[model samples]
Structure formats: C-alpha cells, structure tokens
Target: MGGAALAAGGLLLPGTAQAAPRLTTPSPVALDLPTVPAPRSERTAGSALRPFGRHLAFGADPSQQVVVSWQVPDAVTAPFVRIGVQPGDFGAPVAAEVRTLVSKLSWQKPVEDQPPVKPTTVTQYYLHAQLDQLIPDTTYYYVVGHQGYDPAGQHTRLGDVASFRTAPAPGRGAGFTFTAFGDQGIGYNAAATGHLIAGLDPAFHLHMGDLSYANAGGSGKTSDAYDARLWDSFFVQNDPVASRTPWMPAIGNHEMEPWYGSDGYGGMRARFTTPDNAWSQSTGIYSWRYQNVGLISLDGNDVCYNTPANLDYTKGKQKKWLESRLAALRADSGIDFIVVYLHQCTYSTCHDNGAELGAQQDWAPLFDKYQVDLVLSGHNHVYERTDPIRAGKATRKVASGDTVNPVKDGTTYVVAGGGGGGLYSFPVSDTYLGHETGNDKPVPMVVSERGGHEQTVKVTWSRVRYTGYCLVAVDVTPGAAGKPARMEVRSLTEDGTAVDRVTVQRG
Candidate 1:
C-alpha cells in the first residue's frame, strides 16, 4: 500500500481514426524501460515507499487486456507489478513503465530553512503495468511495489495483494454492469458514492471528469496557485473504490492547467492509461466495447465554452472521429447500445453550469442522427436527465418510470455530476421532487450556455433531477434473436438509494 494504506493487457493498439495505423502488440521484451531516479527535493515525498492509488483501465481491448496503474511519491528503485491467480503466489513480476510529472510551482521553492537551491520541480512518479491476453471474466491477484518493498519477496509481508476482473468477452452477451459519474473531487460524499459503487459491483467505473479538482481553477487559464500535491491526497481518498474498480475517466476543464502542457492534459496523460486509438494526442478521446455496449469517452474540453481553454483544439477532428465511430457502432448488429461520456453536459438546465453549446453544436446532432442510447456528462454538480431528445427538442415526455426506446424516442442525456464535489443549484426548482415534495413551486427552467445564450423552456422534458452525491449504475442485458435488449440505468445516492432510474429498451 502506497500513500494512505487503503485496501487495493495488451491487445492491438487500436488507432483512433480509420486512417490511423493499427498498432500491433509489442513483443513482451519491448515493455522494458530504463529506470529513473527521484529528484533531490521531491524525494521527501517518499521515493521508495509502498504504492498507492492503485487503479485499473482498459487497453485497446477490454476483455483480453487491462492496464494496472499506481503512484509512487518519489523515484523508485525498480517499480514492477506481480500477478497471479492465487492470493500470495505471484510467480513472475513484470516491470512497470514509470512516467514522472515535475511541476514547477513557486511554492515548491526551497524555503529559508532548507539549502538554497534552484526552483525545485515537485516530481511525482506514475507507474503502469500492462497485462495482455488476460483471461476474460476472471479475477487475478496483483501487487505493485519496487525492489526493496517487494510484496512478493520473502522479507516483505505487505498484505496489499489486490485483485481485478477483466471485462467479459465482447459481443458474448455475458450481461455485465458498469457504473459512472463525474465531478468527483476529494470529499466524504465522493468517498461514500465510491463505496456504494463498489457495493454495486460494477465491472468498470466511468469518471466523466473533474477528477481531483487539483487544478481548482475551472478556467483553463494559468492557475492562481496550482498544487500538484493535491493528487496525492485525492488518490488516497478514492482508493477505497477506484482501487478495486477500473476508474476510466475523461478529461475535464479542471484537468487542463495551462502550466502543464498543450491543452492542459499533459498531467492527465501522465497519470491515466486510457486507450490511445484516437488521433487526439491529448489522450482525451477513445472508445472501447464491453459486451453488447460500445462506450466512447470524449474530450468535452474541445467543445466546452465556459472553460474555453482547449476549445477547438482538436480542430473538429474529434467530432469527425466520433461520427465515424458512432456510425460504425450503429451499423454493427452486435452493439445494442452506444453510451458516450464527457465532462460538460450537452443538455442541462442548471444556469450555473449551463448547457455545453460547443458539445451541442459538434456532437449533439451526431447523437441525434445516430440515435445514441445514452449520453452521460458531468461539469454540472447535480444529477439531471433530459427527455428523449432529437434535434434539441423533446422527442418524448420522459417522466420518471417511463421506459424509453431510444430507437424511437431518441437519446436520453444524463448529467451525473454529483460525484463528491460541492453541489450546484438550479435556477428553477426541480420538477420531479421540487413541488411534488412540498418545496417551492416548480418554475419553468432556463437552459443557459456560452455567449450569454439562455432559453426559458418548460419543464416537461427534465424527467429526473436529484441534487446529491451519486453514481449511475447501468446494467446491460443483451437481447436474443427474437427478444429486445433492456438496460436499466439507476442513479444511486450515497446511501445506496436509487434517486433516479430509467429503462432503455432496444430490439
């Protein structure tokens, strides 16, 4: 266990674009990389300490591949990962590829008490071990540590052998469940929601964005005071849940700190091991499949207006790639549902967060044209769901308890931002629970976006709006030859109550 002690694959590298070269799996021997040492100043953060923030992500392929990643505060001697089916008998250990991020912050400069030194870069090492050809739907025990602190070695008795299960075989109709939420910062509610998600036992967890709020400045401009050390606390806080479940995340505005790199996701790319099949170098956009569902993680910052940091950074290439992917997925008979997740909400009523007009212009029409089953988003720190929509209009009055067939009713947009961050308020009272529960009168809601654009609309389409920390659990039941497939999406509160739920059926 690194940081705070918490209980914690290679398929072909698929290119993001159709024209991109398909990456073949590298030879096993090709995974080796030379070791790097921790800087003098940053070594105090714990260079050779136990690993922490252990989490998982899918490689190009979900079933036969998985990426195990963790963080070491300082430089490690020889960081590696050992895996096996048994709890304590890892036969061979695979060396982990280490990537370090050094943040040059003024506050990190040596103080009066310390030896006078040049501006010290607060260095943090992120280690990743790619496990390929893993058995599908099977649990494997693994441990992450360096040379001296080896968990599999005889001298060390570290009881940090964690386990993770690979995704079920794609198109196998294995019937798996996945959970998702965004805007999860470090807090009690976020930790509670994570535990609830783990209780639900989802195969993977989708963190739409705004992961740690480390880059607290929502705007992508230069931070007032960027603190790279915050990730140490946030990852430790989230270890209870993310340590076990695969924490697949999308890039958010907060993740785009201008001090880091172009488009502000250089820090993110260093930490996460998301699929790089896309053409975007930021590693913000990628796609993967789990059973009969196709999940696309988009870079909402490319279309977000409030932040405007990296708007159009992709030069509309992400949209083109997305359209191509959606069209291909829709044409595939085996893919019954397409769920796209991003940071900004494409359609949300909260005036604070507003609607992501860039997302609307770039991807909403494509979602409508392809009839995407579900669009999940964050940025707005509340749980909000739109009625089945087509061309920015309600296709069906999606009241709670109504089962919607997206093929006929269009797509349902979900704003699941309440994942531990401070909740934001809505301009109008909530329609579902606001007036129905003896609160203020449910006034007509106004959807606001960038450029001071606001539209006062009736509340007939906003079916479920819950203001609290929650996680969305989606169960995909594949349909047979003659039967229709069913998906039950539930927004569970920190207390494990289903605050909002919807059933989407497709034949």
Candidate 2:
C-alpha cells in the first residue's frame, strides 16, 4: 500500500482514522498548598522511622556499582545503607548523603475579594548511598536508615528488608528482562500498572518521566498550583515495586520546576540518585551498558516543543554528547544493541502531542545515523509503536510476528506512556496492533506544537496503537558475532493481556 501524505494542518489525509479528542489541559487555578502542622524537631528517633520511598539505581557501571536511595520524613543524622548477600547479616554500613529540599509555595487567593491564602514551606529529606564492587548477577539485601532508625534492628521485621541484583557480567550473553513506562501519577491505574510490572520480575525499570503530577499544572510556572505533599503519597504508592527494582528515569517536562535551582531539576536531584554523568545540571541524561545492551536516557525536556521552559539549556551540547555515546557503544564489539529512551516520543499518533518535532529534529537523525535499535518513550498517555523508520519515514511496515534487524533497517519507536494516566483515543478507529486489522484510509496526526498549533502528518508507520494503561516488557538475549542477539518486546495491557509483540535482532 502507498504511504499517507502529510496534508495541511499537519494531519494525515482527512478521513483516515482519527485520534480521540485532545484532553483539556489543566489550568493553573489558585490552589492551597498543604500545610505541615508539625515541624521536624532537631532530634528524632531514627530506627523507629522506617524509610518509605526506597529505590535502586545503577552507576556508570551496572554490574560493579548500584545506588540505593530513600526518603525520610525528618532530618536524621548519618543516614546510610547496609548491604550484604545474606538477608540476615547486613555487612558494614556505608555512609549516605542527605539532601534536604524546601519547597516554598506562594499561592494567590482564588477570589481577590476574600483573604489571601498564606504561603507555605514544605521541607523534605532524601538520602542516597552508592554500593560499589558488588558481585554480578547476585542479589543483595539492604536496609536504609540513620543512627536511630535502622531497618536492621531486631524490632525491624524481615519484610522490612529490600533487595536487588546487579547486572550480569559484560559479554556474558545471558538473558534478562526489563520493563518501561511513563506518565504515572498517584492513581489506581498507576498502582495497577506497578503491580503488573512487578509480575514480570524485570531486572530494572525505566520511567520516562511525568512521575507523580504533584504539580497538577504541567507547565513550569512557579504559580502553577504546587503541592509538595502529593510527592509523599506518590512515592508511597510506587514503593511496592520501585523499592525492589532499579528505577531509572529520564527527565520529563513536568519535572521542570523553574521556582527551584538550575534547569528546574533541583527537586529531581534531591529525590533520586542518578549517575553523575549529565551534561547540564543533574538533568538525568546519561548512558550505561548492561551486558550486551547499551542504554541511554536523554533529557526530553531539552528538546520538547510542548514545554519550552529552559530551552537550549545545553545549546546542542546534549545532542553532541548523545552522538558520541552512540558511536562509542556501537563500536564496542561486545555491545549488540543500542536502546535510547526519553519522555517525549520521536514518533507517535496520540491525539494530544503526537510526534514531537523537536525530538525528531534534534535526535532522530542521530538515532538513524547510529542505527539505534529500539527507542522507548512515554508522554502522551497511550501506547503507540512505529515501523522501522529511516529519515523521518517508515522504511517498511512492521507487524506482529515480524522479526526486525535494526542493524539492517532503521530504528523502531515505542510510546509506552500509559502507566496509569487516563487513556487517550485515536482520531479514527481503535486499531490495535496484534488484535485488529488496519484500514487503508489516513489517520489524524499532530505535526507540531509550536505556538499552540499541534501539527500532524499521517503516515503508515504506526504499526501498533492501543488505548489503555500499558507498559513494555522486553526480554533480551545476548549474542556474539556469529550469533545475533534477540530482543523480544511485548506490550501488555492493564489486564495482563498481550496487546502486541515484536522481535528485534541485532549483531
């Protein structure tokens, strides 16, 4: 079949399937910031206070190093992490660094006629400890606390112990699985998606950003309805699975807090412990290698059209860093595949912010140039996938049961933004990937979001599109020169149904 043309208004030819109507962007209405009734005293019992938001992250090397992080309600002295192979015996404790963030919110009175709501100060404490020289592919138990609140205490039960396994040794050619999604907030759907991701027992998980939506208004305005308490609730909701899995992430637009320090990642830096390899100030743009897969997490906010706050923060430094990283990874003989992830997708047919032109312009060429295998993203709160694309167009159609060789063809883009946010609709029919058949007509597409104009160009590259809370689970098998590696990607719905699947081969 012939490809669809980019018609006027950045849409697919009219009458092609249409996406559901765009969601009403939440306005920055006057909102009262939650008040903390009691301030944290200078002295507090540590051992009795258990950590809530326990999470894991990888350093420059996944196998040799892992970063353990968590949050405490009050300031605790000498916060640290204890790690050991055996559950019962946690070896010597490694000192953790404490970073305290105070969010100052000045909410304007909704009704000028009434008394104005006073400003509020919300202070939070976060702790991080890096565990080095860890054994590969070995599970290690850990506990987080300071002098008074040690989870290893006799009173602390076994259930309080959290554990994680390091990545497999490099060039081991071992098989492993990982999952990814984005746009999750404090909701039932997000919780449900976390439960589903846990079922997969992935080695690590990637969150493409828009984490909690604590700032209901996604725009990066200081006056945009700020509530710091929502983060506490959101972390608790995610603690079930994130406490165990290595939760790596890329910066989303919502994470941009202009009210805070440099580049709006100030809050993010205090919350999570990421590799200290970002070009800009703690933007979470870095690269790492796990066995045969070389992974990169880009800061999509730098190249996003919808959120132009802090535009050109890197002034093309990020793009240059990405190209260098991709080239190095591709040249490595042990590396079999290159996977890049970010918040905004480079290709999608979602109604609101379909394919972001900034992403395509800034990074798509680099992906094509490097022959990156799979690009994962989530921002539109839906599931969408593109066929093998080259030069901003589909080189060939990809369907379920199809095996694609990224080394031979181009990269495949995936939008797994349905991690518990409200579902989005296709402009036309709901054409599921593996379950439904496709129509010949063109579909609605958003071409750009410049000056509030969301332009779209309809094309046949949309191989799979599903409207539901979903995520991507990928099982990877490493291989040498003679034997090519295989990545089996499965898109699953909330009910554990397999919406779509594809095999990507790389040598």
Candidate 3:
C-alpha cells in the first residue's frame, strides 16, 4: 500500500534452474528457456513458433525451507537444478531430485504409452533438493543441475549456481518481504510481467489462480505443465527470483478437475507437492507457518465442485479442518498473526459464478469468528480490496499507530487473479449475480466474462466460468514503533507495475 496506500510491517529482507532436452540413459533431456510469442499457448511450438515459459515461482518450507522447480525443453538431454548461496556462493553445493522429461503432452494416454510416450517434446520438472530447516533471514546459494549418475556415473547439470535468502523470523529485527499479484493469465504481457515482478526481488511469491489457457479446457496435465514450465522458464526457470524465493499458491477454478487427468489435478499433483500429511489433507488446501505469520492455503476447487469422494475436500471436511487449524494456531503462543489465501474472494458478486456461496457461507463465518486478519483470492481476474469488513459492514482500513482493528476477529479480503492465464475487460458495472452471495467492498464490483457450462464442460468446477491467472507477494516486518506494519495487496498491469494497492491493519 505504500505505493498506492500502505501501512508498514517490521523490517524487510530479500531475495532458477535448468535441465536437458532429450532422454538417454545418462541425462538425454535438453532444456531451453522458451520465450513464447503471445498468450504462450503451447509447451513446445510445433517447429516455428517460440516455446514459452511464464509461471516461474518458488515456495517456502515453513520459515527455513525454500524449494524451487521449473520446466525443461526437448533439446537438452539430462536436467537438474544447481544450488549455492549467491552468484559465487558455490562453496558447498546442495541438489534436489533429478527429473525426466514429460513425454506425452496430453493427459489421456493409452496404458501402452506411459512415461516417455509420444516423446515429441520433453518438459522436465526440477527442484532444489533438501532446502530443509534453514536459519531465518539467511540467504542460500544454488545452480541448475544435479550430480546424477549419467551414463556410467557421468554427472550433468546445466545452469549456474544462484542465491536466495530465507524468511526472517519475526523476532529478528525487521522480518521478511513478500508480494501478491492475481489474475495474470492473459499471456499478453505475461513475460514482461514476470520480469517486472522479478525485479522487486522479495523472499517468496503467492499466486491466486488461472495459470494457463490450457487449464481453461480443464486438462489436468495442461494446467500443471503451465505451472511447471511457466514457473521455471518464463517466471522462474532460468531466473533466480524463484530459484531462491518461496512460492505460495491458492487453488483456482482452472486447476480443478473432474474434467481431465487420470483422477483430478494430475498435473498439479505432479508439478508441485505440499505437506499433505502434515495436517492430514490432500489437494492444494493446506496450512503452514512462516515466521510470525500463520498462512493457510485452500483447495478452492472443492468450493466450486463439492463431492464426498472428493471427501478429501468438500464442506464437511473443510469446516472441521478450519476449526482445528485455527484452534491450534490461536492456542499456540509462538504465532504473531494469521493470514489465509484461496481462489475466491469472500466479498464478490462472482460468488455465484463459481457456485462460491457454499464456500463463503462455510468459511466467512469462521474468518469473522476467528479474526483471521487477511484473505487473498483471485477469480474476477482483477484486483479489489475491502476496508476491513465484518459481517458485511465496512470498518476502517488499518493505518499507522492503530494497534488492532476494533472489530472482533475481523478480516480484509483481496481479489488478485492475474498470473498470465488471460486478461479481462469488464468493469464493476453492476452487482454480480448467480451463485455468489457476498458484498463486502466499495461498489464497482470487480467481475470478468461469464464462463459457462462450455467452460465447465472442459474443466472441473465450471460453476464460476471465467479465465485469467494471478500471484501474491508479502513483506513481513516487525510492527513499526510498537505498531504492526501494514499488510498490502495489489494488482499489477500487464507491464508489471502496480495498478492498485490496499493496506490492511488491525481495526
């Protein structure tokens, strides 16, 4: 909010890899960073067009842990990530799992064509192995490759070593830095946006949803491929931004599926893995603690597509989990504050689009009841914020000197759906209608093109028919002069400059 309007936090601190293209016994996959033309529509362009990479990202392991992953191309043979502290911090090296190339681009494959089937292009996924419990506020080094046993124990790794800093503990003088941007899937200025975002150089990044146009069709692999490739190649692949910074993502309608994949989210599941067993839950919805912040990531896919077999998700399970998670967090003495992220904004007219009424009805009460601080979401493919709403009433936005919001356990919601999927061209002309049922922001409802059964027919949870992608960044600092620093949320334009911003503080 400092740019548009912001409060302050404690202090600030800051912040890729590569692989092979082909496959052979000893590292055959060659990986190239695709500089896609427009709307980055393909994993590998047939022959002429440029292969694109867009959604580059990184995620944290609680506070000390930072993991990085990205896509590899078909030309490079064996691929892996390099590790170190800074540019030359390569004193000691750490490596993560070595990934093979993705043979079949499509999710539906004959049992006969598994693994390397339809090997037209190779999309390798790599991680920064074992970035385990690190010291808060410390930076690490890395490069792109692995000490693989390539052909008779030959080793291979393509990129150079890079550096990244861990999140600072709240008790550590100033703290950490994070940023959030939603609704960026247009592919229009995605590459530029990634570069723009990369310049800010925070500790970690957060995404709202709608990562790719392919996901709009709801193919599980398509969506995940977008995540891996875009993240590494365009967003983080050869880039150091994500190689060292952590990434936190919220489930979006595009990533949900009964529509494609062997089960659901085959791509998402394969592309990124979270600590599901930690809280005993599957899917993207889970929670982790970062410094003094308790962050919760939710599986909004279930919010739109509710079912029991999806029992892993659904209303009943989430409600129970929410209560239990909050209870534990509140009970703990170490936690300083709480924040939550998901694909749906609690206060929006599009609630009906994604059939989000169920989610809102179920979660809003819990947020209000628990005083969950802040909520981040994407769906409108635009950015909007509330001035601290409690039970549908406007409270004041938190500012300097304010100790806490007077409202009991109140929260502020932000809609940030823009991560290169697509861009929207709608204005908040009227109140949103359909399945959504919450109104907690200034008028001029932020909305997008109404996706329909066709959209849903192709993807899972068609309830909220729409398109676009998004990401978020957070900066955590100790309170200023005894007051908590403001929490800011913003939306970036295709060029990567802030379009709007809002600051959140205790009432």
Candidate that scores best on TM-score: 2
**Sort order, lDDT high to low:** 2, 1, 3
Better of 2 and 3 by TM-score: 2
Count clashing residue pairs per candidate.
9, 23, 118
Candidate 1 lDDT for residue 438: 36
Clashing pairs in 1: 2-50, 2-51, 9-130, 9-131, 9-132, 10-132, 15-277, 16-277, 16-278
User: Residue by residue across 272-391, what tens digits does model 2's lDDT show?
Assistant: 777767543446788888888999999887777776776677888898899999999989988888999899878887777677788889899999998999999998888888789999
Which stretches in model 3 have alpha-carbon errors above 4 Å? Answer: 1-62, 71-82, 89-95, 98-128, 147-159, 186-188, 219-240, 257-263, 277-281, 305-315, 350-355, 393-409, 425-474, 490-501
**Per-residue lDDT for 264-315 in model 1, tens only?**
6667766778787876353668888888888899988887766677878888
lDDT of each: 0.75, 0.78, 0.47
**Candidate 2 segments exceeding 4 Å error:** 1-38, 107-119, 154-156, 280-282, 449-452, 480-482
As a TM-score, model 2 comes out at 0.88
RMSD of 2: 11.9
Residue 248's lDDT in candidate 2: 89
Give the distance in Å from residue 172's predicted Cα in candidate 3 to where it truly belongs.
1.4
